[model samples]
Target: MGYLICILLYIAGIIIYGIVMGKKKVKTSDDFVVAGRQLPFMILIGTLLASWCGGGGITGSASVVYLYGPVVGTLHFAGAPIGMLLLYFISSKVRSSTKITVPEVFAARYGDGASIIAVICIMLAYVGLCATQIKAAGNIISLITGMDANLATVLSAVGILLLTVSGGMISVAYTDAVSALLMVGGFLLAIPLLIGRAGGWSEAMAAIPAERLTGTGGLGVIAILGYMIPTISLLLGDQNMMQRFASAKSAEEAKKSNLGLFAAEITVCVLIILMCTIGIALFPSLDVPSNIIFSLAVNYLPFVLGAIVLVACVAFIVTTADSYLLSAATNVTYDVWGKYLNKNADDKQKIHFMRITILVLTVLAVVLTLFFPTILSLQMTAYTMYGAAITPALLFALFSKKVTKAGGIAGILTGGVVTVVWTMVLNSPYGIASAIVAVPAAVVVILLVSALTGFKGEETYRRLYENSKS
Candidate 1:
């Protein structure tokens, strides 16, 4: 009950902070969406770390490690570090280009058709991304408090919606910095306590299966690749990450922030894997492995420490949910409605639309929880959808000067269609991830179509690349 109360208070406090920010700092859509493109490097680092390593790392990655083993967990997460490194290069180009959303980047290069397709794909991907965070939050709250999962989902959604709609990026980014500190502190504190309770390293190592200790956990090569590709693709094209770059004060700040984010992500990934395996050692007969972290906090640790860790984990869930919700709403407002539906809409009008869109998207995210059994299950699908559909075109157009507009359109269409059909219709034939098929398909289409159609123009590419220089 103390854990529950502490977490509830934290949630209430952040929501109130968000409301205050909305009234004071978010008068214009620019302030609301990107904080007027002036976020400092330290705040960017915190927001990037906080948003990236949330429920996805804590709940989704932990569940994979518990069920599969360290090998799969390592493979699943290896792409994130690689993706962040790649983003280090990609961020400068994005910041220099001054594109607010990924679709805006697409529109600048590939024209309106590319932008429209990107809007559809972004909405599809982000709604699922947001849904996974919402589900993870509900799972943690339910496990700790013994509340009904459905009620927990509703409550979690409401808090996330409030935080996201309250002040857009301004609220989300500042709160995320605090959440990141709490997350790292919570895990650091729990490590010693958990090890003491588990009877030390050697006993803990012997408690789980020997196969789980191996490099592959007895799994095949294709299975590992399936886990890796989606993660890389998701990081490569994540609009939430892209928007953070756009929010940076300068291109150099955006580039430097990735270094900080890379360090934070690696630390969080290693700690989460350690905690999950330890969870298996402590509770070998646990019926549900996905609840490993929360179960340990409630049942294994002392009261004060457990409450702190619990609140931190809940903060992780809340921060991530709100980030994606705000990103997706930004897509509808700036990319979709602002361009096509309301070309002359003022800042206040766009901000109102963004709030309405956020409310609807939150409802959809909650509804999606009923379909997936776990956060990890939906995470892969959502990640693949964005990585496969959007990343190829977005990256190629941003960096490749000779790339034709036709090629961008072809890549988007092929990648999006292939991922949906393979996952939903074919049900992942041969146990290969949709990313294994979709990413290569998108790349192939981009290359072939561009070669056939020839270059569209070099001046736009030249302008973007020239400004991108540090």
Candidate 2:
């Protein structure tokens, strides 16, 4: 009952914070979408950290550590921080761009056709990503309160929707900042307690599977690369990351925020690895690996410590869900409705449309959660879908002058189609991830098509790629 009370308090606090911030900070569509372009360095870092380190980082990575051990798990998860480091190089350019959505970025460089394709891919990918968070939240709540999982899922989705619909980016970013702190603090407190309860570091090490202790965790290079590439690609082109960059006060703040984000990301990755490793040592055989972290918190730690960790985990999942939910809705508002359906939409109409889209997308995400069997599978699929479909074209637009509009459209279409075929139709043939095949295919197509078509958007390319240098 105490645990339930704590979780409820945390939820109530976040909802209240989101509502209050929404009323105070969110007035125009610009404010709702990008926080009036005034986010400071620390808040930028916090939002980035909390948004990226969602269900995938907490539950999905925990499952990997439980199965593969710490070494391989850490390597598998390293793609995110590595991607953040790579994004750091281009943070200034990303921030300098006036575009809000990834689709808008495509439209600026590749034309409207590419923008339409991008909206399709983003909606497909982000809905799934949002669903993963909902699924994780449901699992956490169910475990904490002994509630029915489906009912818990509905409640979790409601919480995300309420928070997201309240203030858009303003609510999402500020709540994300708070969640990031709680997430790190909880993990910091839980790690030592978990390891100590498992009979200390040495004894815990003794109990882990020998294969898990090895560098590869017996998964080998090909499999590890499969896991790593999609995350890297996703981060490189994630709409949530791009939106946060757009929210920063200036390019310099955006660049500096990347450094803070990298530090926070690495900290979370290491802490999760240690906690999951301890979980493996204590519970050598569990029916569900994803539940390892929650299991440790509920069954092993003391009441206070367990409640803190649980609240932190909930914060991670809830913040991520709302971030993606809001981001996907932004893609619709800016790229689809505002761009095509209602070119003359006022600030009031745009905000209303965005809020309505959020509610619709929330329903879509809840439906999607029923399709995937596990958080990891859904996570990889969503990551690969967005990464392959958008990242190749996006990175080319950002860095290359030779890319043609024809090439960009072809790349986005090919990447999205191939991912669907590979994962949904062929069932990820031979146990390989779609990213292993789809990303390279998209890149190759982009290069070949651009070479054939000749450059057409040189001026736009200069604006996006060269002018930002000034």
Please identify model 2 stretches exceeding 4 Å from their true place: 463-470
Badly placed stretches (over 4 Å) of model 1 are 462-470
lDDT of 2 by residue, 1-470 (tens): 67778877998898898889888988899999889999878889999999999988888878988999898898888999899999998777788877778888898889899999999999999999999999998998888778998898999999889989988888888888888888889888888888788889999999998999998998978889888999999999988998899899888888999999999999989888888989998899987788888899899998998889888888889899999988999999989899889999999999999999999999999999889999999999999999999999999988887899999999999899999999999998888889999999999999999889887667877655444421
lDDT of 1 by residue, 270-370 (tens): 88888888887898867767778889989899888888888888898899989888888888899889988899999999999999999999999899889
Scored by CA lDDT, what does every candidate get?
0.87, 0.89
Spell out the clash pairs found in candidate 2.
none
TM-score of each: 0.97, 0.97
Clash count for each candidate, listed in order shown: 0, 0
